[model samples]
Target: MKSGCQWRMMPKDFPPWQTVYDHFSRWNKAGVWECALDKLNERYRHSKKRAVPSYAIIDSQSVKTVYASEERGIDGGKKIKGRKRHIIVDTVGNLLHVSVHRANINDTKTGVAVFERAAEKYPSIKAFSGDAGYRGTAVTFVEERLKLKLNISTKIKDVFAVLPIRWLVERTFAWLNGFRRLAKYVEILTATAENMIRIAMVRLTLAKLP
Candidate 1:
């Protein structure tokens, strides 16, 4: 296939393109990716000797797509193109939740789902940090449903204070980009794209294991 041809030209040794493609496709079909994320989250919770995250930082990023058919028209606002990636990261920068949707979905709308899911999984989250996009209902839900305080950065000064802590999640995303499959939006199905993200996270965690 086309992917195999691209792999052949690369300098490093890799599994046959067909094998990589098939593994990813099968895992996505079986919902194995989500299950893997849950497992990793549980591992982090149980293995940590100190304490669970008290504050979490949430954000979304836009990943551009080359194929028009792959693009979903979710009013990306000023950045009106590609898909949206919603991620919730712990204060220390470990990923807690991740979701992918069409480009136009409001960040607030998705924030609730991410918070709900994270609370159900971790149950120890006490606070969350996000950008202004998460101000409205999302903030309300975190305080009411999850009983966690919300800290959303708005002004330049607040941004400066939170940027250092927030960079952990961004760094993780950068690590994900090392995988060629994530370098570009190649998966036609949304589920497959999510599976790729989960796989990258699992691989990253395993690499860090002592």
Candidate 2:
């Protein structure tokens, strides 16, 4: 994953490519990657002397998708034809939850599902920070449906200053770029794409543990 090499192109020093891919596919289907991420996130948070996070930063990224039969579409705002991923991260940048869908889907609609899943898993999260992209129905959905607050960070134009609370999730996406495989959506299914991201975070969180 770090090298982003194709499955069959994996170095022979490792196990057979099929063997490695099988284990990865099985784990993805079983939710092992997410479970490990949760356990390791808790451990890392405890090491930092933090409590279960009460707030998180939410953001979405639109990436170009491979020309395939995958469920991909154009993000009119970004003018990119691909899939969009919504990722939620804690204040310290640990990944909380992620979801992938067609780029044409509205952020508010996707944000609801992402927030719901994360809230169910981490009930302590009572609020979230996001940019103006989630303005209209997003804030309302969070308050009414999820019983959570969505704080839209003020957008400062003509300048590159970082928005403290919101940039953390953007940095997480930057970290993802380090993995070449993530440069584009290559998986045949969005569910697999989502798990592929979880797998990337699992590697990152594991490194921080020891």
Candidate 3:
């Protein structure tokens, strides 16, 4: 899946396309991918001298879906028809939580889901940061329900200056983009797409280890 080639286009040296897909589907359903990601993430955290993240950052990206599916919608702002990936990352850019929804969903609405998912897993997470898009009701919802500080970093005067704190999540997104399959939301199922991200994180965490 990482190769970005169509399953039917898989090379002869690889396992039969159907065989490979069956394993992928089965593992996704069994939550093996998420478990692997959590273990690898713990290793990466220890490598950086941290036990768990004290705070997290949230962000979303809209990508165009390749096939017609009920999981897609039009992102009027980006003008793309597909889905939005709402992801929360730690200070060092490790993924903490990820949720997918129709691109048309507002950031504030999905922000709640992302924070709740992270809060459930990481009790140490006391705060999170995001761009102006996460301000207003989203900020209030997270703070009230999840009891996490929501920092809204406004744009700076310089056109090219990177925003503080929030940039970490953006870098993580870039890291995920390195996996060609994630360059677009091609998976027919939302869970499969999310599992693909976990697989990419597993590869990243392993690569960072000596």
Candidate 4:
């Protein structure tokens, strides 16, 4: 995944590409990647003397797709025809959850689902922060329904500045960019795409452990 090498093009001296893909596909469908990320995350947090995250940053990135990819759409705002990766990350830039979907869907419409899913898994999170795109009823849903807070920071016009909290998620996106496979959403299924992201984060967390 780091090299973005085609499965069949993988060099010899390793397990056959078919065997490797078989395990990846099976584990992705079984949520093995998510479990691995969670455990590694716990270990990393403990090593840092940090408790479970109390707040998370949420954002989405739209990327183009291969011609034969499935379930695609155009993000008119971003003017990209592909898919959006909706993700929530902890304050220090650790990814907490990810949801892949059609790019055309507005962030406010589906952003809450990712937050809710993460909240259910990590009940300690008390609030979230995001950009202006996530404004509207989603804010109410977060504060009123879930009884959590959502901070929406509008970008400063005519100037460049990295807004606090929100920048952590942007940085996480930058970290994902280091993995060449994430250069584009190349998976046939959105689930597979999401799993690929989880695997990347798991590898990142492992690097920080003993």
**Per-prediction TM-score:** 0.77, 0.95, 0.95, 0.96
Which residue pairs collide in model 1, if any? 74-104, 75-104
The weakest ten consecutive residues by lDDT in model 3 span 63-72
Candidate 1: worst-modelled 10 consecutive residues by lDDT:
1-10
RMSD of model 1 against the true structure? 3.9
Which tens-of-lDDT digit does each residue in 88-124 have in candidate 3? Answer: 8898778888888789988987887787878889999
lDDT of 2 by residue, 182-202 (tens): 888888888889888988888
lDDT of 2: 0.87
Q: In angstroms, give how far residue 82 of model 4 lies from its true place.
A: 0.4
Question: What local lDDT does model 3 show for residue 30?
Answer: 96
lDDT of 1: 0.72
lDDT-best of 1 and 2: 2
**Clashes per model (N, Cα, C within 3 A):** 2, 0, 0, 0
**lDDT, candidate 4, 47-80, per-residue tens:** 7777799989899999999877887999988899
Q: Give the TM-score of candidate 4.
A: 0.96
Model 4 residue 92 lDDT?
63
Lowest-lDDT window of 10 residues in candidate 2?
Answer: 155-164
Model 1 Cα lDDT, one tens digit per residue, 88-125: 87754567878877787788887899888878877777
Sort the candidates on TM-score, descending order: 4, 2, 3, 1
The parts of candidate 2 lying over 4 Å away from their true place are none
